[model samples]
Target: MQDITDVAKRLVQHNKGKITEVYFVACGGSLVDMYVSDYFIRSESTTITSGWYTANEFVHATPKRLGKNSVVIACSHGGNTPETVEAARIAKAAGAQTVGLTYNDKADLLAVSDYSFLYEWGDETRVHNNPMAIMLELTVGMVNELEGYDHYNTFMEGMKLIDTIVASAEKQVEPRAKAFADAYKDEEMFYVMASGASYGHAYGFSICSLMEMQWLDATAVHTGEFFHGPLEITDENTPFILAMGLGRTRELDERVLKFLKRYAKKIEVVDAKELGLDMIDDSVSEYFNPVLFYSVLSKYRYALSKVHNHDLDVRRYMGKVEY
Candidate 1:
């Protein structure tokens, strides 16, 4: 993780002001790409064009939507999945400079990219996506000229703050994740509520999308559309996770918190202000919580996977695929 961030700083130094804005084309694992793009938005002037596609349709559907003056940022944990690699190929043929971020050194994803960031973990670390997302956050920070912290030393210090919060989170993670998972586990459907930068939380919602691929149990809803009515009807078996959000409208977040406590069956908060990091307050300002979110979120999912008898590395089955 340290080396990935350091290399990213160099990439940012190298690419500083070279382009007008970055276009982050995210695909592959949902939370990983979502947080990476969130970090990019903080680091640079960026626009995200989703790179996801139905594997069969991507070949004909991509290309015209991508091209010069853009960078295709692809995330593939395995590094060599057929659809992701082929999507990277389409991204390149359209004249965009491609960069592959992944855990392996050599794979078809790297083959199609002009540049790559390799994290060296062949599978998601500890069967959660934190290691990969951390690398992506550092990559975005590095490429954005490292705006907030002038020295990498300061960034390391900030990470230490995150580590401290993570320790406390370890004590509470299981209970919180299980509370939501147990409620959600039996549901045929549900919604995830997120808005603003926290809207990136929807990436986790994609567990339902890929669950068909990996066959996990997940259902979710967005926060805004949810509160319009259903907020009053939830029970223990159906719950909502509040990415209560941050920034100028913090008063609104307070309201949401109150409403969740009153109307919803349960509420779980990934409080940016509580992460025991220098960035905690800043997580609210910059939505920098994604990096913090990844570490803690990874643990939550790990606990739930155990209770459900699902593979920890749900994206990879029994270590069968190697890149």
Candidate 2:
């Protein structure tokens, strides 16, 4: 397997000044993973435009900005997501530079991309190994190269402390995960809330873990939009899981938290600030908060699985039938 770092360096070197926009294409967990990358590039770069899109949408309504100077990044965990593969093919045909990241080297998406990075992760048990961090580093590394951010190396150095951080986060979330699982293992429904960097965690956890893995009904609602419609559905008995991160957007999450406290009877807040990320440098903590926040909250999946007597790998329609 090629080191993703080497592929990242090559990608940065080849397209440093030529690329104008980044189009992230994928579906489901793959799409959610790229959200942080899209957010990071837009937050840091002055000239570069970045957007993440679901594969099917990207195919039907291709962005006008996508062209030879754009970079399209496509990823699929199984490497066989039909829409993602087609999206990569379309992007490549449009003369855009295409990069593929997936756990499977043989994935159809890789075949259509210009450069590919394959990393082996068995059964996807560890959230830290989800490739979101690697893709985030790659996108940020490009920003550092082009915009003189110069934080890429420092961020990479800080990432060396990730194991320590994840361990601490795990310890903190373990009790909460168990507590939530013990309380709501048999509950009929759940709604997750997050905003900004932590939003992907909420979306991914609600759909991937709760709905798909645990076979439960779950909805992911952005905190900023909670009051627009979702808030009305809240009641004393409604279960709300809030994944909060420390960043400029923390205030948005806090607003939702305040309302949930006032109305909802069961509000479980998994705060990234509560986790020991003091080991991480303040300069990069905000950018990496999603990784940290999700690393902790992913524990709840396991706890819920165990408490509910459902195996996390159990699925009904994912691989069982054609969609």
Candidate 3:
């Protein structure tokens, strides 16, 4: 596999000053994975605009600005998601530079994209090579090349610790994860909450882990938007899972935690600060919080699958039925 940074460098070099916008398009968990990149580019890049879109919607309502000056990063784990493939094709047709990330070398998404990256999966020691990490590297690489990020080396240093961080966090959260699964096995629904970079973790856990895998109803609520509407659903018996991050927006998660502690009896928090987020420099710690949060919370989902007697791989309609 080509080095992700090298891939990013080539892409940025090819476009240089001509690139003005980036669009991230995917579906399901892949779409959720794009959240961090979308957030990072918007926060770091002054010259570039970014958008995150569900693949199907992106196809139906292609952006007017998606032309020669645009770069579209599309992902599919297996590289065969129809909408994502179509989205990549459309972006290519519109003269936008397309980048595809997938775990499969033979993925259809690679055909339409100008650059292709194969991210590592199912390997604990190679956690740094996961899809999200690859996207982060690509984003940071682009920003560093375009506008010069002072903390670029810090970000690179943090990547080396990803495997250790994920392993340590998984070990630390194991007991809590087992306890949570035992306690919540009978629960019918859950509300997951987080803010900033960690929000994508919440969204993926809610939809992919709980709803799709366990057949339980789940909703992901943004901590910043909780009081506006979602807080009304909270009560002593309501089950809630909160992912807290150590980022600039940590205050938003703190506020939600305070409220949840006050009124919600069933609350579980996966805090990045508690899971060794300090191992990375403060300047770039927030960008890595999602990785820590996702790794630890995955333990909970595994335990839940066991206690609920629902195999995580079991699905009713996905891939087996037409929508």
Give one digit per residue, the lDDT tens place, for model 3 in 253-308. Answer: 99989998999899998888888888999999999988787778779999999998
> By lDDT, who's the top model here?
3
Give the lDDT of residue 228 in candidate 1. Answer: 75
Query: What lDDT would candidate 2 get against the real structure?
Result: 0.81
| Collision pairs in model 3 | none
- Candidate 3 ranges with C-alpha deviation above 4 Å: 123-125
**What's the CA error at residue 258 for candidate 2, in Å?**
2.4
What are the runs in model 2 whose C-alpha is more than 4 Å off? 1-9, 12-16, 122-129
Please say which candidate is ahead in TM-score: 1 or 3.
3
Question: Regarding lDDT, does 1 or 2 come out ahead?
Answer: 2
Distance from true location, Cα of 16 in model 3, Å: 3.8
Cα distance off (Å), candidate 3, residue 87: 0.5
Give the local distance difference test score of model 1.
0.54
TM-score of each: 0.69, 0.91, 0.97
For residues 198-259, could you state the per-residue lDDT of candidate 2 as single tens digits? 78878988888888888889999999999798889989999998888777788988999999
Pairs of residues at least 3 apart in sequence or in different chains that clash in candidate 1:
191-220, 191-221, 192-220, 192-221, 193-222, 193-223, 194-223
Residue 192 local lDDT, model 2 = 90
